[model samples]
Every structure is written in structure tokens, then in C-alpha cells.
Target: MSPNPWWQDRVVYQIYPRSFCDSDGDGIGDLRGITSKLDHLQALGVGVVWLSPIYRSPNDDNGYDISDYREIMPEFGTMADFDEMLAAMHARGLRLVMDLVVNHSSDEHPWFQAARTSRDHPLHDHYIWREPGPDGAPPTNWEAAFNGSAWEWNEPTGEYYLHMFSRKQPDLNWENPALRQEIWALMRFWLDKGVDGFRMDVINMISKPWRADGSLPDAPVVREGFLQPAFAMVCNGPRLGEFLQEMRREVLDHHDTLTVGEAPLATIAQGIELTHARGGALDMLFQFEHMDLDSVGGHVNGKWALKPLDLRDLKQTMNRWQQALHGQGWNSLYLSNHDQPRPVSRFGDDGRWRVESAKMLATWLHLHQGTPYVYQGEELGMGNVAFDDIHDYRDIETLNHHRVATTERGQDPAEVMASIHAKGRDNARTPMPWSAGPKAGFTTGEPWLRLHPDHDSVNAQRARADPDSVFHHYRRLIELRRQHPIIVHGRFDLVLAEHPLIYAWTRTLGDERWLVACNFSGDTPVFECPAELAGREARLVIGNLRAGAGERVDDLQALVLRPWEAVVLRLLD
Candidate 1:
């Protein structure tokens, strides 16, 4: 048997620091606030904590537009506070993973400032700069992820700089060897500080592809505004593997750490090459294929417009990834994060059956053959917020999209607001509810953003007090993974693949097999054992509902499942 890496079986919990907890009673959460919550995470059975960006920033993109890579954001805390937090996490046997956002930097960063000062400056080539077109417009029709043109003019330098997200964030030029070395040194700085790993933001977009003549080309127009989809040229470029392997050799080989790259447009073949043990590229990748299930018109439509999710598409996408990387690579499983809306609101029912649906979603994701990630408030089954007014929104991307849709595209404001309410990132940015207090027990002062109105009934304190709460259900699921080797190493086989309301699968290891069945809808359904599983004796392991003595199955048979119910059973010969 091969040696097991520390991360293979570990459950990772992601904390959006700005909304996790507030220590100084201020409106924002800080490193010290996270330190205070270590016990909560430990009790939840999480072995690793993956924090979103906490680096110094101008708040243009909520910490993604980093101004200083080595300094902590003043709003969060001082450098000493970060050190103290790291020490506290270590003492509690929890590893820390920092966000690495080297794809771009804040315009206020010294390098970008110098680059903008003059074309003769030594750092002028540090970022992607190009002269305006002969028509005095942008060099290309490439559209930004946030709605406008990707290129922003710098008056002083008489050149346009590329920004994939926001104008305040200027994309770096990875073609420069000096910049690569600088990034490697920065990685070394964090490793020396004892960080266990990095979650690289848009890491796959570092290596951009240029034309054979060394000139940038215009992308194919996909929208009415000549908004070309630039991701095709920007993501998983030709030299991405080369750059990742080089970084691994120069910086990562020296430290015993984990690295997961956020590759938005990467394919399964690319994922295999990036994470295969012998590939020397990365440990794993967060692919977005499954996340785009509700997206229409492919990548051009983005996530604003929603479509009814097809269960067949979902199953095929997941099964492909699991089977492709069964032995050669690893997978990172997640349902929601800072960039997504609440899973219960987007995927499961958040109304009358919130608790039951949340538990079912957790069971479905955690039982998959991969390392599981639990976002903040996920264990408590927090639902999405319903902000009626546009002024209540704080996310830059949401605001930009609203403006572009209503003002430029002539879309109705009410219709745009409806989409925003359903899929906006702000839904996930609300302050975490620790208790049923005035401000959700997140801050003594007014929160930076509004708290969810339903926090009174769905807070962490309330869940911990109830033995049958969603929090306890998640804890039990985590514990099950640790106790059963089949869950971590067994081969996966999809069962009831075409079922519209039920998701069922089985994991087999040597002579033992575990069967998992989940009902996703609010209606009761009868689930029949598959032909291969017929005539096999089974023992109930864990489930959301109690199995009475009269209802227990002594032989292979069909079972009536309640709304949003999930069950795990062990097959005994």
C-alpha cells in the first residue's frame, strides 16, 4: 500500500474572514476573530482551514486586488495578530492555508504605480500593456469578467493595461522571468512563516497565449456589445503546465505543503496533467465544470442567468471526473464558497424542509471520492439573503453587472434585481450568525453588510444546543469518513443514474461495499435495490431518519424514503 498523504482524508473548512467573526466589536472580522473560533471548527471535525484573501488591499474587489503580498490588511489586523492566529491554529492541530492571488495586483501596488509613471520605468513591462488601436479605442474587444472592457487606459503612460476583473486590478505579465522569480520569493516568504499551503486564485491563467507574430488578437464576439469571450485565450494556456512545473521545482519542492489551483475553464485532461503525482504541477485543482450546470450559452452567459439543472448532466459531469482521476490524481469536492450563493438556496429546498435538504446535500457531497470542503455556516444550513434594494449590495461584480444589464443592455431593473437575488455573491457575504442577537452576534457595532433576517432561528449557538440539528448531522458525517476506510479509498459506482428525484451510489473495497441513497426532492419516493445489490444482507450505518425495528430491512428490498432523506448502509454477504 502506498503512503497516505495528510490531505487525502482531511476535511477542509473555508472561512470568509470578512464575515466569519468580529473580535474587536468592529464591523469587520479579523485574524483574531478567526483564532477565537478554532474551537468551533475543531468540534466540527475539520483538520484544515482554508481562508480567503487576507492580504493588504484597497477593497476594490474585496481583497482580490492585493496591494501588498507580504502585509496583512489593516482592517483585519496587524502582522503580529496574524502570527498569533497561526500559532493558535497550530496549537489546536489545525493547518492553515492562505489565498495566493498573484494573477493580478491592486493598481496602488508599488510595481503598478511605477509601471504607470512612465514607459521608460524599469517595471513598465511588469504588467500587460498595449497601445490603443488606430481607431483610438481599446486594443481588442475582450470583455472583462465584471462587465466592461478588459483594458483600462493609463493616461500618463499612454497605454492600456489588461484587467480581467476590475480596472483597479492590473493583470501581471508572467512572460517576464523576473516577475516569476519575485512570485517564487513571495511564496517562500509565506512558507517560511509556517503556512501549510496555498489556494492559488486563477493560477491557470498565468500563462497567456499570444499570436505567432507576437501580437494580441481579437477574440470572437459573443454578445451584442461586441463583448468577446476572452477566457478561451486567457485560461489554461499552452505554457501553463511548464510554469506550474517550474514553480514546483523552484519553490514548492522545498516545503511539505499542499497546493490547489483554481482553474475556471480547465478540462478533465488538463486536470489530470496538472495533478497527476508524477506530473510535478500541483496537488489538485478546483474545476468549474460542475458549477456551471445552471449557466446558459456556455461561458459567455456567466452565472447571472439561470437554467433548470438537468440531473443527467450533473451525474455525467461528476462521474467523468471521478473515473478519470481514480488512481492517477485527486479531486476537491465542494458545493458552495465565497464566490457562490448558498448551496441550500441554489440546489436544495431552503423553505419548509431546509434542515432536511441541507443534511441530504452534505451527505451527497461528503460521500464522493474526494477531499471535502465545508464553507462557513454550511454546517448550520444557512440560507441565502433576500435584499430588495440595489443599494444594499456590496459586491463589486454584482454592482457592475447590474449597471451593465439595466443601463447598457436595456434590461428591466426589476428583472435584473430578481436574478441578482437568486444568484448574487452578496448572498454568501452576509455576516455569519453565531447567535440570535441584534446583529446576529457577529459585531456589536453595525455590520458592513446587512445580516440575514432569518438568523434568529438558524444560528450556530442554536444548532449546537440541539442534538438533531444540521450541525450535528455534519459532524457525524465527518466522523464517518474518518472511521471507514472504504469511504476514502473505495471505487465508486453510480446507481440509479437516471433517477429524477433520487441520487444513489455505491463504493466497493475488496469484499465490503457501502451503499448511499439520497432523496433530493420534498416528495416521498420508493427506492428499489439495484440488480447487482439484490439478495445481499445490509446493515444500516447512518441516516437522517430513525429506522424502527419493524422497518429494518433483513433482505434486499425496496424502501420508502422521506422527503430530503439520506441513508448509508453496509452490504454484508
Candidate 2:
């Protein structure tokens, strides 16, 4: 409604610390490494950098299980290094957004240690603790996101602690006002230290109160092959809005900072209510509906079919969000993040035609109506890493799922492995392909993890030299979005929704109108332009191939598109 907000025009880059760059030659990425790369990030036109968890941790969940929220992890350097990184980022006109994992804390944290020491201790109430059932088993049938039961037996306390994730990371008791205040104080500390904002980790899950009665307030939905119904009950609870609003009032709203919640399960209605401009809660939230586009089913453990999306479905999904949040909230749009597989490998053709297909995918998504987020190595058209051995894995969730499907669930190991092959963390977490050198130039040693073998051919060094590479295409895309006001503030409208392979939309802001069309299928698709968009002259702004200028499809005329080809047109009155 108003002029596009600063965030809408900016490109946010996600950096997973461990695999980004190793400064000290220890095979682990650190703050100094990120500081050293500020110029490269700035050159790419990134306005904000979202760093994954770098807080003090046991590395059980690779920094997600924070032991100390106030301190940086030793492996990632000290708080001083972080401060220096922040200053350097500011010098480059880039903002730093740190991960805030308030939903849980590492078991080794002082609060958890004190809680385990004595039942009467003041810190004992900081985390969720419930009495065991009559059979001395877990209090409820709630399942952990990784695998089996959510509750872990605590012998010292003679009770079970709630861990929606790994056992080493216990969920905090947000129902306790004192604990909530402490979290607020931590937020204030970070903001005082010059953090632009926070990328809230599982921020919605922090709302659930531990009920000793083992009965969730809302009924659970148990779909076929779907195990975690507790996710629905715990995520986005009744008190979620209240908690987020308090957070905004105490920390984010004060500085007018950017706060994007990692709220994958939140509905569009909930997102609008929480992120509306009138200081509802967050600036935006990441939804996984489109991110999970190629999956075989909605279930995480199922095999991925690599199915190309029906253009109509993609258009409807985007239209639903755009229409819902038109004037109320904002959007954080992305194709690849740390937890998911690489976009090019899963969505685009990454074999012989990697560069072309990758660029096409970039054009189709980044030019849409939302703030763009580029995960590390996405610029290089990086694909999923292939691993033949179990030792090649570094992610805890992947390992746990492997064990569950093969051991407990009694499924064929090959079939389980096939699912993992299609979708695995190694897809997004492989070492950044900096150059065609030892360790893909990510490290001098044997790397903390396996580097994708294709790094030799798909490194940034080569992409930077090629004008047609996906990396350069991203640069052009960012520049175009940054310079165009209408693309940022314009209203989104779906133009053609009946075709299964042709997705077309238009953006209108004042006198400027731009039409974007894409072919989601591998075969060429055609669509007839609506009468409302019929015009005598429309110039081709951009396309997958150099179709040249002055190409116009008048209203009522059918336009044909090659497989995976996308185009943008400028309407001239």
C-alpha cells in the first residue's frame, strides 16, 4: 500500500557458518572468514546477511543447541570477532541478522544444569519438566521431530524433560513469566550490541505450555505416514501471538529492526496477523509450502519424486499469499535454505544444462513479489552432494531419520537410502565451491565435511567469469529488482491459471505494469493473454533466451513458451 519497505527491496543472503569459510585453517568456518568475504557479498548486491546459529553450543545440533545465548561459540571465534564482523558489515552497507534459538537450550546450559541439580532451585522452572506416567514412561505420546518420543528420561531429576528435537536440547518453559523475561533480556542485549535484527529459530514453537496431563488443547491430525501431529499442537499455539507481540514491543519494535520468524507451519492468516505493519509481531516469516515443491508427499520421510510443479498450482500458491498479505504483512521468499536440498538439483536441470536451467529457475522466483533470500552457494548453481557411505553425513536430523526408517520402522535400507539420496542436508550444507582446488577451496584440510565432487566444475570462480552463469544472472536479477520500484511495491495478480504448465502473473503499481510468465513443465506450453492485458505494444524486458526487443503478445493472442522458459514484459500505454 505504502512505498515498498526497505526490506522488500533488499536481497538477504544466508550463511551457514561451519561450511562457509575456514579462516584459521582448522577446517571450521569462523567470524573472521565471514568478515574477509564482506567485499564479495557487497559486490553481489546483498543488503543483509542472515547468519545461522553461531552461539555457544555443544555442536550436537551444530550450534542450534545453544548453551549460552550471550556468547559466541569458541569455534566461531569470540564476541570480539563478532563485533568486528558487524562493524565490517556496516562499512559495506550490509546489515547482520543473527539466529535466535529461544525455543530451547542445550542441556549443558547453566539454567538446565541448575534445573537438574535441585527441584527447588530457581532455575529449575526455566525449562519444561513433567512427572512420569504410572508405568514410569514418558508423560505423553508426543513425538520428537527427529524420530520417536519427544520426552527424554532424566534420571537425576527423576522426571522426563520435553525435547521436540534432540534429547540434548530441552525446550524452555515459556509459560513461566520469569523465563520469558530472561529471554527478553537476552534479546535486548543482542540489539544493544548492534545486531540489525534476529532470524528467530522455531519462534512459533516457543508458545506451547508443557501440560502434565498429556492432553493437547487442540485435536491432533494423524495423516497417513505422518508421525508428528504434536507439531501442529505445539507450533502456532493460542499464546503465539501474545508472545511474539511482547517480543516485538520489548526488543524489535523499539529499534524498527527486521525480524523474520522461522515459522514454516504458520498459515497465511496467522502470518498476516503477526507481521502486519501496525507492530503486530515479525517483519516477515519463512513458509515451506513452495520450498517443498518437488517432494513426493507432504511427509518428510517419504521419497522425493523430483516432480516438476504444475504452473497452475504454483500460481495459486503465490496468489494466495500475495492476496492475503497484500496490505497486511510482508513476505520472505526463498527456494533453498540450510535444512532443505539445493534448488538447482531438485528443481532445475543440473546435468549437462546446469547453467541455463539454473538461471531460468532464478529468473522465475527472484523476480516475483517478495524479499529474496539466497542460501550459500546458490549463486554457483550448486547441486546435491552424493554420498555412498554413512560416515559422509554430518547432520543429526538426517542420521536420526535414517535410523528410524531402517531400524525401528522396519523398512528396506535401500528404499530408505533412496529417499535420503533424493532429499538430504548434504544437499545444502556441502562446502562452498569457491574454486577448483583442493577441498573446493573451502578448506586446506580434509574439510570438516565432504565436499561435492562436482565442485571442480561448478565453483564460483568459473561462474564469475561466465556471463550466462547462474551467479551472474543472480547479480543482474538483484540489480533489476533493486532499481525497479514497481517490482518491489506493485500488487501481484495471476493472469493465466487454467494451464497446467504455463504460469503467468502481472504486477501493477500506479502507471507501471509488468507481466511475468514462466513454463514450469519440461515441455513447451502456450497461454492466451486475458483481454484486460491486451495492448498494441509491449516490449520484452527479459527472457530465458535473447528474444530481442519489441516482442509483444496482444490481448486475446496465444503465446508459446519453451520448456522451463520464463519471460518478463513491460507494458507501454
Candidate 3:
């Protein structure tokens, strides 16, 4: 069998610099801290480490709003530290994927600072700007991703600057040819520094495709304030492909680097086209459809309310993306990230069966035909942290949503606060539970962020000793994927013959075929398969339970799948 694509077969581990580990006893994780944990990550069987932004930032968005593209954040480390970290990672046979936040820069960035100096400044045109209305309000009805108007009033320029996110982050004017070339040069700078690739943050938001009159694309459902005409006008603009191609030629094409874009508003077709490995712009793009399952109403553009995800919709969405992007682009499979809450609390029964359900989720994601990414603390089955008050939140997005859900949306403040508690970045931002000691051994001093109260009980040390813990299960799952080529490069066909709760799929390559059946419900679900479909006897490859190999004594028989149980069986001739 042909070896799979490098990234398709590899697993990535995400590191949030602030919470990873602190070497200086400063209560914040840094480059040295990450280097120290490289062994831990290597032991986890992860081929790559996807780091959150360590670029110089004002920390308004915790490094998302970048102030410098070249330098490391002082709090994280210096140039020397970054160099050493990269070298150390390479030495350990681990690839490093740096976070790229080029769509917008912090207002404090030299370019933006110069632009704000005077309207006649050469850099003044680097960012999108427009005159405000007679009411001294924003230029448009567009909303910021962090809340409030997308346009931020600039007193110096006497114009409102556009920021798709926070006011501190002004969107760059990619329409300028000079700006595009400059950004391309910056990308090469990192590649030259021995970095593997980039995780482009909000890469889709770089373009501005606004018409002269600022009218959005005249579509019937294209309402105001959601996806402005400017968004389409800007995103994937006139020269997006060209710029990406140039970057590929100069930066990515030469090296075995990976580029995964945080494409939020892109459709499945658009995502596939943009990430085609043959000649596409990026290596992969994350689709938010599955992540948005908890969103209420069909209106995908407004303040979201938590809703139960139907098994049918969830299975269908995953199947669609897997099938459509088969040969074109790859997939970046993840259930949790810094922007999301812990998956166990949100999806699994964290209260009763945390480890079993966590393993179930891991099997469900890792066995799929895509590269799996494990966020920090995910392997240990971390759950959501409790936040008694709004002041406990440090994320700009959560704070902004709190305002909209309460004041503008006229919802009860208590309910809004409760939702934030249930679905907040702070949940994921809590310190990693390294041990059972105070502060979970993350820091001797008070941590930059609070540790989860349950850290004492649920920690890495305890999980490491327990063979049946989620951590060990993850290790076994990764080994299974790495050892079997079919798991990575095989054809994925969803088995919808059974109930939606019984999410089963088959992967096959040549004579090698495997069936992965998962029961998502609490009650045991029987998965029925036809004798002809089985082709031959099937032996158990991996199961979340303690069942041994070749226990499959059935073709049209009942299989007892306990709560959140998953099984991967190898078809034997």
C-alpha cells in the first residue's frame, strides 16, 4: 500500500503557550516551557505541535491581535529561545506549526501606528477606512466578531477603521499590491527561520470585496450586518489565489511544510478548492459546520444559543466533509481548541463517564480519514471550569457576546452569564493539570489563569499510572492509526443503514477493509450488517471496552455496544 500524505497520517498536539508550562516561575508558559514538554508530546505519538500565537502582541486577545510578525512575544520568550525551541523540536523528530495571524494586526503595530499618524501617511491606506455617517456612528451595520460595530472610529484620521474582530485589530487592506508582497515576504521570513508551516488565523477574513458604494452582493438571503458585501469583496478577493500561489512558490512549495487555514465562512466546495494539495492555496481548511452544531436557529449569523445536536445532522455533516474532500484537500479533525470549551463537558457525559466518553470521542475523531489535533488537556479528559461572575472571563469574544445576549438581545443577564459559563474560552484557557499539587503544579505563584477546581482529582500524573485512563487510550488509538495505512488513506463510506445514533463507517484500500462502529447514545445499540457486506470474518482491531480480539461472532447478529462505546474491526479473509 502507498504511504499516506505526511499530514494525513500524522497527529498534531496543540500548545497554548500561556498554560503549557512556566519555567521561570513567572506563572506563564514560555518557549522553554514548551521545549521542556516536547518529550511528553513526543511520547504521545504526535508528529506535530501546533502552537497558538507566540508572536509579539498587545495581549488584548491573548496574542491573536499581533503587533509584530517577526518577533516572539516577550512574555513567551526571545528570538534565541524560539530558535532553540525549533531546533529542539526538530531534534525530537517533531514538526512545528506556528500560528499565523496576518489578516489583521494590533493597532500598536508599527504599520498601523504610522497609518494613524496622518491621513497623508503612506501607511494610512494599509487598513480599510471610511467616513462615518452624519450620526457619528460606524460606516456600516456590520458587526465585529468580538461584538459591537465592525468599524472603529479613528479620531486622528477622522474616519472609521474596519476591524472584523477587536478594535485593537484593524483588518489589513490586501487590495494594495505592495501590502500583499510585503505579507508574502513575511511568510518567507518564517520559512527561512526553519519553521515547518503556519496555522493561518482567520485567513479568509483577509480580503475585502466591497463595491464602490459599499453595497453587499445582491443576494436574497444576504442580509445586512452578517456577512457584509465588504466581506465577500475582501475575502478571496481579486488576488487571493494569486497571492497564495506566490507564497506557495516562494515559501511552502520548496519545503515539506503544512498550511491549515482557519476558514470560518467558507463553504465545503470553497474549502475543498482552496486546500487541494496538488495546486490549491492551503494544505487544509477547518469547516465550522460541525462545531456550530450547538448553535440555535437556522440563522447562523446571530448571537448563538446552545441547542442539542441531532445525531443525524452531526453524522451527515462529518460524512459530507470527509467524502467531498477525499482527494482534493485534507482535513484538520479537532473537537476542542482554545476558542472552544472542553469537549467532554460540552459533548460527552463528563459527570459520570468522563474517561470512557473521552476515549469514545478520541476514537471517533482519530480513526476518521483526517489528521487529528489534540488540544492541551484533552487527553486527560478536561472538563469546563466554573465561572461565578462575568469578571472571571478574559476572552474579548465572550465578554462581547455577554453584552449582546443581555442588553441588545434583551435576554436575561443571568441566563447570558450562565451560557458564558457553559460555553466560554476560559474553560479551555484554565491551566493544564500537570499534577495534584497546588496550582496543579503549573506554577509556584498564582497562575495567569485559574486552574480548574477538579484539577486535583483529574491530572496528568494520575492518568499516566492508570492503564485504562483516557491518556493511555489515546496513545493506543494513535498507534492503531499509525500502524494501519487504511486508517489514513482508505475510502470512508458512512453506514447509514442503522439508526443515526449508531454511527458506523467503513474504510477500505485494496483487500484491506475495516469497519468502525460507534454507539453515541447511553443505552447499548445493536449494529446490524449484512453477511454479503462483511465479505469475510472480521476481527476486533480496537475497542473502548475490555473485549479481546476476533470476538465478532456475527454477520447479521447483535453486538452489545455499551454507552459511548466504539469498536474498530479488521476484515479478515
Best by TM-score: 1
Give the clash total for candidate 1. Answer: 0
Clashes per candidate (backbone, < 3 Å): 0, 0, 7
RMSD of 1: 1.8
- Candidate 1 minimal-lDDT segment of 10 residues: 547-556
Give the lDDT of residue 352 in candidate 1: 92
Task: State which candidate, 1 or 2, has the greater lDDT.
Answer: 1
Off by over 4 Å in 1: 1-3, 222-228, 547-552
Q: What are the root-mean-square deviations of the candidates from the true structure over C-alphas?
A: 1.8, 2.4, 2.6
Residue runs of model 2 more than 4 Å from their true location after superposition: 1-4, 209-228, 296-308, 547-558
In model 1, residue pairs whose N, Cα or C atoms come closer than 3 Å (at least 3 residues apart or on different chains), thus clashing, are: none
TM-score on alpha carbons, each prediction: 0.97, 0.94, 0.94
Whole-model Cα lDDT of every candidate shown, in order: 0.88, 0.80, 0.81
Model 3 pairs in collision: 207-234, 207-235, 208-233, 208-234, 209-233, 209-234, 216-229
Deviation (Å) of 156 in candidate 3: 2.0
Off by over 4 Å in 3: 1-4, 212-238, 298-303, 530-536, 548-552
> Candidate 3, 291: how far from true, in Å?
0.8
Model 3 earns a TM-score of 0.94
